[model samples]
Target: MIITRCLRPSFLAKPRLPPLSGCRQFWGWLNAVFNRVDYERIKDVGPDRAASEWLLRCGAKVRYEGFDKWQYDYNGLPTGPLGKYKIQAIDATESCIMSRGFDHLDGLEHLEELKLCQCIYIEDTCLERISKTDNLQKSLRRLEIISCGNVTDKGVISLHSLRNLEFLLLRDLPGIQKKEMILELLQKSIPPLQIELDLKD
Candidate 1:
C-alpha cells in the first residue's frame, strides 16, 4: 500500500475555537481545507487538546497510540460531507477511545481499513454502522479487531457487506458465536479476500 505522511502546515494560522454548539460547522470547515490531501498513515501522540476535534475535521487516515489518559466522545469526530475521506485506521490499544454513539462513523464513505485493538466499549451497533454504510463496506479492504471483548457474531455479520475486502484478522474474541456466518460472509462477500480467523470461546 502507498503510505504518505504530510506534516500539518506550520505557517497556517489556527482557527479560533468555536462554541460547543457549533462543533459541527467548525468541523466541516476544518475538513474542507485539510481533508483533500490523501495520506496512508498518520500518528497522533502529542496532546494538542484539539487533537480529537482536529482528527474529525480532517478526513485523513490516522493511527492513534500512546495516550492512555486521553478521552474523547467519538460522536464529536467529524464525518464530513457524504463520501468524504474518513479515518481508515485507529490504533487505540494504549489509549482510552470511547464512542459517544455508533453513528459517529456514519457517512464515512471512503473508510477502507479499521483497527480497534483494546478498545473496550465498541459494540455491535458500531459494527452495524459498517454494514449499513454501503460505501464503507464496499470500499473496505482490511479490518482488525483484536482483544476487543464486546465484538460478537452480530458484529462479524456486519462485515457481510464488504464485497471488496481482502484481509480480516480477529483475535481474542471469546463472545463471537457465529463462526459459520463469519466464514460464509468472507466466502460470499469477496471470494478472493485474504482472511485470518481466530476465536477463543
Candidate 2:
C-alpha cells in the first residue's frame, strides 16, 4: 500500500513515463472531465468536489453536472470478463450525490461496497435508488450510512431490496426511532446481515 501511494505522484513528475500507464490515463481523465479545477494533487477542496476528484483519480469513470452532482459513466468501458467495478467507498460530501444522486450508481454491475458517511441532503430517496440497483442485488457486500441527516426508517426498509447484502452500518440519523422493522427483517433473514447502528441523541 505504501509503495503504491509513493508511486502515484510520480504520475505527473515525469513526461516520458514508465510502466505505470494507468496513472497517465488517470490524470488524462481528470483533466478531461473537470475541465476546470487545476488538479495538482487530490486535495479535498470542500463541497465534495475533492471526493469526486479522488474517485476519478482512483480510476472510477465519472460525469458531473449542475452545481454539485456526479455519476459514473460505465457505458463505454468493458463489461465482459474483467469489467472494472469494485467501488468500496463513495466518500463524497457538500452537495455531491445528494437526494437522488444515487440514481447514478444504479447499474454499476460490480460495486461491492458503499459509503455515504456524511451528507446534509442524503435521504430515503437515495437509499431507495441504491436498493433498486440492478447490480447491487447480486454484488453488494457492505454498506455505510453514517451521520446522514435525512435518512429514515423508510430508507432503511428499502434495503430489503438488497437481498445479497452481507454487512450494514447505520449511524447518527434523525429518523429511525424504532427498531421493530429493522430488527425483525434482518434477524429472521437467512445468511443474516451483519448489522451495526448508532442512533443516539
How much is the lDDT of residue 140 in candidate 2?
79
Question: What are the C-alpha RMSDs, in order, of all predicted structures?
Answer: 18.6, 16.6
| TM-score per candidate, chains pooled | 0.54, 0.56
Consecutive 10-residue window with the lowest summed lDDT within model 1 = 40-49
Best by lDDT: 2
Find the 10 residues in a row with the least total lDDT in model 2. Answer: 77-86
Candidate 2 lDDT over residue span 51-81, tens digit each: 3444444334333322133354323422323
Note the Cα lDDT for every prediction shown.
0.58, 0.59
As for candidate 2, its clashing pairs are none
Q: After TM-score superposition, what is the CA distance of residue 59 in candidate 1 from its true location, in Å?
A: 16
Tens digits of per-residue lDDT for model 1, 128-178 = 766776666676778887888888888877777777888889888887887
lDDT of 1: 0.58
